[model samples]
Target: MALIRFVLQSVVEILVLPVTILSYIGIWDPLYKRFFPYLMVKITSAINDKLGKIKKELFDKLPDFASSSGLSILEVGCGSGANFQYYPWGCKVICTDPNPNFERFLKKSIAQNEHVKIARFIVASGEDLSQVASGSVDAVVCTLVLCTVQDIDMVVKEALRVLRPGGAFFFIEHVVADKTTWLHFFQHVIQPAWRYFGDGCCVTRDTWKNLEKANFSELNLKHIIAPFKWSLISCHIIGYGIK
Candidate 1:
């Protein structure tokens, strides 16, 4: 079984190489934009069903805004707004992303998620969110975004800076697996190609460790194997912390 897994992984990598190259050249942007959301709806929905109570337990507890209206959430990388439906009721969301290709999907998501109001759509990278005021939002929600940022530290710092005291940073991101495992070795080997094709994603990134280094206390965090048919990049952590 292990040998078969290795063979399958190798075959998939070989097939994605050319596609990854095109992605690095900017040709894959529109294609990814068009397909990623659909893939996510299928993937994240299953994840929700499996994670049932866990998802609601955390999101329901997010800090409320000063106006008592709702939680003020600033989502970094807000990809196609895949997590929009899960947002708490009456939450005010500030969406930020570097990719202009996601604008249409985001607008559509905003329209669909009537519970969460769209406050603004900032065309900015996570590392530099100058348009968003510091110590303003009640929470910073980041899902599957830490892996792709050029500077994870800078981006995390900005998240901490913008969050009000006692605000939370909610995250769900895949991370590097056990160092001695076959999967870890495979990830290390294919990281360069993976990032190129995956829009700067690092499947081997120890994102939870990086998050620990940030200026916040850990509230809840644990790793779970992602429930995808293709599980190579499936090891992920889901949790949040107060700022």
Candidate 2:
């Protein structure tokens, strides 16, 4: 079975290489943008269903912002606004992503969640959020983002930079499996092809280490293996860090 899987993966990689090269060269951006949100919706819906309780608990840790205008949250890599359902009631969301293709999907999502407010959608990368001002938002949220960024540290720093004092950075990310495990071995072996096909996602990233080094005033994080049968990316870290 393993041999057959390897052969299939190799064949798919061969077929995908040309498009991957185009994607890297920026020539495929428009098509990729159009397709990625549709793909993510199908993928994340299953994930969100499985992780709903866990996500609710994580989002529960976010402190209530007692202002008449309501809480302000800046979500990095807010693809399709998948996490909008779990947000605090009446909170205002500022969405950011490198892909402009997701804005329509995000707006559609916001329309469904009537309690949530849309601040704006910024076409920006998490690693360089210069468009967002420093110490402006009450909190920053990231879901399944750290692994795909070009520089995880820079993204973490940028999140920190935009957060108000005592604000939180909430994250739920899949990280590298334990070094001695078969899953760990599989992650590294399949990473090159996976990164290209999966929109720069690296399964073997030490995302926890990056969060720890970000110097959040308070950090609470833990790992879990989601109930995914025969999945490469199951091990995940979910928690929040306070600035």
RMSD of each: 3.8, 3.2
What Cα-based lDDT does every candidate model obtain? 0.79, 0.86
Stretches of model 1 off by over 4 angstroms after superposition: 1-54, 63-69
lDDT of 2: 0.86
RMSD of 2: 3.2
lDDT of 1 by residue, 14-38 (tens): 8777876777698887777566666
Can you give the TM-score per candidate against the true fold? Answer: 0.81, 0.90
Model 2 weakest lDDT span, ten residues long: 61-70
TM-score of 2: 0.90
Cα lDDT of model 2 by residue, 1-243, tens digit? 467557766776787789778877888766766788889988889989888999898887665532345589999999998899998887888899998888888888988998888889999999999999998998899999888899999999999999888888999999999988888778876876787657788999989998888889989899899887878889999888888
* Candidate 2 regions with alpha-carbon error over 4 angstroms: 1-16, 20-30, 64-69
